[model samples]
Target: MTTAIDSLLQILDLETLEHNLFRGRSPQVGWQRVFGGQVIGQALVAASRTVVEDRQVHSLHGYFMRPGDPSVPIIYEVDRIRDGGSFTTRRVVAVQHGQAIFSMSASFKVPEEGFDHQIGMPEVPMPEDLPSEKEMAARMPDTVPENIRKYWERERPIELRPVDLTHYFSSKALPPKQYVWVRASSALPDDPRIHQCVLAYASDMTLLDTSMFPHGKSVFLPEIQAASLDHAMWFHRPFRADEWLLYAEDSPSAYGALGMNRGLLYNRDGVLVASTAQEGLIRRKKPRE
Candidate 1:
């Protein structure tokens, strides 16, 4: 049986349609729209294929222009922006039905020694101490919402172990910060580029919801509509996506139907690997008249 992780790898393996063009398809998982992380990962793969192997992606900025159409294929068009001595840049546009769904700019750099200093990773319970989804369900069978439980019952490419479950069981307002340990559900190849793509795919998980924390709300709330608007990431160090990594995230503010969130990813050894920032739509939907 093809595992979910296997399916993810297959989707990331884009079909090269023509020079500077690639085609990617979404997993037919019954989602009304394509997942944002999938697009980011696929677009990065499309860009990475055009860059020299020695050059690794150091930063990427993307914007979602429209909801992706999962029923059809997404065409990725890569623009060879520049190839400097130490840095290479590319711009990618994801198109569906001849309309642009997302656009991104990525920069790749040849590994070089540099002055490096990073803040300390927060002290939190490691994955070993945290319970798995099945355990969580068993421990709090009565509290887990049916929709949320159904979502977790499905096979996933990434496994998440959140540090806190209070918010799920209670609607009380809480701090805007959250910590989650995440990794690919299964072992992955040794290729650094694939690891980067897989990490990119996982970045979109359990984020944006940080913004709703202060409002005593969650993305799962029926009245709330959530969507990623823009995303930016800076890769600081090499890390394997198959190993546990801490995703420490916080939301600074939310206003006028928008929420801003930031996350710092650290490997099990506490090395900061990547930092990401995203702004999302968090508007409440109109009630039926």
Candidate 2:
């Protein structure tokens, strides 16, 4: 039986159409727009396939040009920008309906020892102590909004255990910060590339919600239209996606209909494995008569 994780892997596994060209399909999950994380991960995979395995992705920056269409396959066109002795760079553009929807650049490096220091992870309740998403949903079935309930109650490849449940229950304006424990629901193949891409896919999950916190809003609210605008990530160290990792996220500011979010991913052992930043559109839709 194929699990959600398996479906995710299949989605990331782009079909090679030709040299420097690949095709990817979105899961027909009734979403109007393709998930931003999916495009990022697929673009990264497209870039990685062209580079040698000795090198691993160290960082990536991407911009969303338009909302992706879930009805069609996206074509990823990879450009081999440069291949140096120690670093290799590639640019990828995802297209659908004859229009470019996303573009990204990724850098890969051959593993080497380097001076390393990272800010310590914030202390938070262990994932075991936090209520599982399922348990939380079961306990608050009536409290959660219908649209959000549909999304939360479904089986997902990645699982999240939020440090605080207040954000889901209240609309009171609060601090622009959040912490969640995230991990794959099932064991994944022992491939570092797979892990990295999986993490990339999961990074965009809830960071945007931080931005809405100060306004006492949620991206799921119909009155609020939200979408990722741009995303950037840096992988500092190796980590398994199937293991518990703390996702500490915050929004420093939101203005002119945009919100900026930042996140740090730390392994259970408190090793900082990756960091990401994204700015997204969180504009409220005006009501019409």
Candidate 3:
């Protein structure tokens, strides 16, 4: 298996050092701190392990308590909050340096017959027409600003093809909604759980940035600061993370140093597998001359 695929699988193997205590390592070559996606992904895996096969994860809500240390392995403690007939709930606390760096609550639902209807997928160019974010980053010379380059370098495992690259950094105003094609660079394991959690991990990246386009601000620009405060996702259908998925995101509001963004995940077949919403810290700093 390729290294990216291997990382997806290795992430599932939570080290069982003690009862109710699971250890997780970092996927290095990224930020100074642990990637938010890694903690979110690993926490979902930890929660899923404690639930029965019949009950599958349907929704998850998480909060970033503190910055995670990439140098230290995270210890997850799963609390079996409730196990009933129709629904089961699990709480996972990710700790590093003896402090809770992240916490998540996942609810699993037993399969049942239900009526369903969803909005159709938006029409967009195929992933083939867009250049991968990696390719774009490679074109940047060493002269590129460290803050801007680090934003691109820290990204791996998943591939991103923005619909409008210039809009991401341009000083001009743009639309509130943005579309990007995303998928795992390498194929994931056959296990359905791994694919779902990996999708959850990758979902956190760039979706919130869609909101900033309208304001002509980006983390790449010196005047803005961005961070995810909380994230929530709901699984709607089954899909593969290795295959292309259209991530259509939009931000309806940005005020009080925060931005609200929502996105829908659509597979190449146009199946809507998931929906996500997040509110993030969108603080503005003084622009440098």
- Give the alpha carbon lDDT tens digit for every residue of 1-289 in model 3: 3476577668667998776679999866555788788888999999988888777789999999899888879999999999998999999999988899999999999888899889999999889987666566677645455665555665368888877776644567788888889998887777878888999899998877877888777756657777788999999888889999999999999889889999999998888999999998888886678
The positional error of residue 6 in candidate 2, measured at the CA in angstroms, is: 0.8
Which residues of candidate 1, in runs, are more than 4 Å off? Answer: none
Candidate 2's residue-wise lDDT over 1-289, tens digit each? 9899999999999999999999999999998999999999999999999999999999999999999999999999999999999999999999998999999999999999879899999999999999888788788899987666667789899999999977777899989999999999899999899999999999999999999998889987889999999999999999999999999999999999999999999999999999999999999999998
User: Residue 261 CA error for candidate 1 (Å)?
Assistant: 0.1
Clashes of each: 0, 0, 0
Residue 226 lDDT, candidate 1, scale 0-100: 98
Per-residue alpha-carbon lDDT of candidate 1 for residues 112-197, written as tens digits (9 for 90 to 100): 89899999999999999999877787777778898777666678999999999877767889999999999999999999999999
Q: Model 1, residue 35: what's the lDDT?
A: 93
At residue 157, give the lDDT of candidate 3.
Answer: 81
Candidate 1 local distance difference test against the native: 0.95
* Model 2: lowest-lDDT 10 consecutive positions: 144-153
